[model samples]
Target: MDDLQFLDIFRGKLIKLTLKTSSYVGVVQRINSNKTVLLADVVYVEKGIKVPGLKLFFGHEIVNVEFPGKTNSGDRETLGYKLEDHLLVEEFQPYRKSIRLDDDEDDEVVINFEVIDEFHGKFGSAVMHIKKQRLIGVGADAVEAFQQGRLCWLQIATKNKVYLFDILVLGAQAFKNGLSMILENKHILKVIHDCRVISACLLAQFGVRLTNVFDTQVADVMCFYSETGGFLPDRVSTLQEVVSLHLNVPSSQLSSLKMKSQLTKEERELWYKRPCPLPLLKVMALSVIHLLPLRLVLLDTLMTDYMDLVDSYLSSSYNEPGEVEHINMELASSQAVPFFAAGTMQWRHTPRLDLG
Candidate 1:
């Protein structure tokens, strides 16, 4: 594969790209057959800046493209240009898995879990493969478990340097946090940061239209409202509350489970700084582990109250009739089966499945 292709490596990253005639900076929207497209949010010029809706640069016209990390010049001239109206984006609908009968594939499948925590400014995402009560993590401590073949079945993203998993952008809300954080209290920033990363992980991609993937908070809300059958008093619940209610694990026990770390207040300033202490890793690791038990109880709850949850989801009236129809289509095609790569998984008798 052409790993160096600017379109492939930095497909979704915000970039400062220099063309032969002018320099433009924006999010790399997509890489089509012939052109590299950008949502040209900002245009830099000698006198001032401009906000052009969308700009496309031919593959050959692009002279050079630089990512933020590589550009250390610290030029103030290049950055986000303030726009009058920001885009209002809708929440990403959760992916649904579909089942198909294929002799090559087995109906029995392994359960995969991932948890992401934000420390300092960086994201720490942990992955685990579970089957028949066995859990194998991808980390230094989990190596022995892997050697024992506990994780043998997992179709790991890595193979011949190309990762099968691709990063999928769930919503623009994830990118809009900075403005909201300034209005909110700094004390809560850490909590907000943690929650955002977790939300991102829920929407993270291993394969296209990932199935059996969930956010603990979303699952909890569905289960809670399904049981109560009313509008949620609190749209979002704290992680501690979900743990207490669903897993029957209290916050105090979770606190005790975290390993002790030597990180001082000064060092704690940069939580992602390595080597990440054992205590911090333990806490991060525990968050992933907690999801395991939570999934068990919540999954059962969801199945029992599936219709109630559907009613709750559909109850929200959309402004446009087409919008409602679109949601119905998305919900109808969603599957709950184990998801692998896009081509490997196929929906059998999709028309019958959707109608049902």
Candidate 2:
């Protein structure tokens, strides 16, 4: 079925959707295809952040949608919870300092271009010259290359179309198994591991010690489960359900984004005898492409709904008389549970046991 057709079925149902600028969790109160209009009962921000007033949610503004539970299967009705957005923080102003890039004030150059990684080797010398000149590029892996003391791919997860200037540094202080702290419980880990590549990446990239680990699933569960009688053994929420409940997205679209390889054993065997399908490669790429926007939506929800909760975890001490220590020692120490160890020689081939 064309995915757009699901919108007709979604009418009167609850959804979490990501608008161009913000996120919302609401019910599809009205959908007039003739008028090209959509109206939703906005109950949640990030599907967890509660705010006042009903708002207009345009179909074009919707970047993604999720449907929670099994409404199609007649299993449940309604989206489940009410919620909140971020609390405000105090403002401060400081005199900024300037530093010269190089000794020669007359030597200045600026370049703007986008390069796909497929052509990375072709532009190797040009990129090296730019790095030597300390020139910055805006697309994707450029800034990451500048970091880690090398202008090349590292053991880090691939970041797509990221602007280095737009990056937000959460903090400097490190935490052990910090991913687990935001993950909350074991069931959440299993759910993400089952469908999403996030858990595996976290373990592979950071191992136990990590900085600024925030899992959106944790925020969603806290918001939804708290209002709907908390977590029960049989009622664990999936990523789709959480996104649907919090982001105002629909499940049908989420399923499409997942793009589960439906190839059977016979089909797989047949495909192995020939060149892989181009559509299959595109489908795989789409899976990763869809995840980036979803991550942003989840991050927006987490930061908005739990700013205070996050602040409470930070340290109250000062690094110096004027500089405050923002590291959260208590929070960091709390996450000292076993986390996956990816590079250990003994466990390299072991699929099940990597926790250390």
Candidate 3:
């Protein structure tokens, strides 16, 4: 298989590509967009086409973009003429999983969970073959993603070659790490950092970082080294530190004894600035209640005030359609299960069961 052509996933959503071969700069409107073909706006010397500055004097000509890394000197100079600068962009979305298509003989077939689990045994495995199929299916997706060289470029040079423990995975692990630092029942600044990191990492692929009040490496994760007292400390241990050490993680994990503070009771007033329960969880639960076709307002969110809020603001509004699905997905993830007794019930109905 042509690994190079398979680089479509690397084809960014809305990349700002500059034409290397031409006299004028042309902006790449979209590549790997959901549309069948890409649309680009050229600004240089082209005619006939109407752009603010560029005209398609000649018919459309396909200009190539050089991926940021690993370019040879000559090619770099040619593509370099366009210059490298950050551009606003959107992430590419995969086609819906429910869709089906004609198969190519050489195409590697992947099995999704729903298909395998459809038949418990006769078609599935003897000792839970359906589950085994699902594991294989998901692994295949990861592998196929790798086979196409689409693994996160950030982690490529790292030892494990896996994306950093993302917030979800990190949060799952956090419970094991202990609640002294983070809490499952609440939204910690660290958790917000995780969300930002995941989103930033995705955006960073196109060379972007959404700078906010949170420091680099996140507030909770940063360590500090004080010069005056010859000591090291946690950046988020106080609000004062939050103001000063806001530039990414403090120098390093270790602090020198030369800058030690003589104070005994380490006070941290502003560390946990917002003591908020996961209200977003409530939003999430209500969404699942709305989206899941189950005919039950019997769920907790179905009965709660959150339902009213979602009805007016989000759950009711029709989106133009795209990555906005992530918001819905985040909402569904908020509360894994809802309500009590019948309200919390989640299982296949007994009507389908054969008593015999």
Q: RMSD for each model, in Å, please?
A: 23.1, 23.9, 26.5
Candidate 2 stretches greater than 4 Å from native: 1-219, 232-245, 258-275, 303-356
Per-residue lDDT of model 3, residues 1-356, tens digit only: 46445545443222223344553333332333332224333323332111332233222443554343332232222323211111111110011122222231332232111111112222223223212211110011111112232221111001001111112212222223332122122222211222333333333332322222222222222122112111223122321222123312232211211112122222211111111012211211111111111111112322344555565456434553343343342243323321124213332222211111
Ranked by TM-score, the better of candidates 2 and 3 is: 2
Clashes of each: 3, 21, 19
Candidate 2, 153-271: lDDT as tens digits: 11111222111110111111111212223232322211121222333333444442222333444544434433333231223344445544544454555563333334343443322
How accurate locally is residue 211 in candidate 3, as Cα lDDT from 0 to 100?
A: 28
**TM-scores for all predictions:** 0.30, 0.28, 0.14
Better of 1 and 2 by lDDT: 1
Error of 3 at 222 (Å): 6.0
lDDT of 1 by residue, 1-356 (tens): 66346546555566767778787666666667666555433445332333434677777888987765333232222342111111111111011022121131533232222222222221212121111112111111111222231110111111001001101111223223321222122232111111333222333311112222345666665565445543333334555566556655544564523321233444433332222233443343333334434555667788985665566557644445355543332342235332335223332322111100
Top model by TM-score, which number? 1
Please report the TM-score between candidate 1 and the true structure. Answer: 0.30
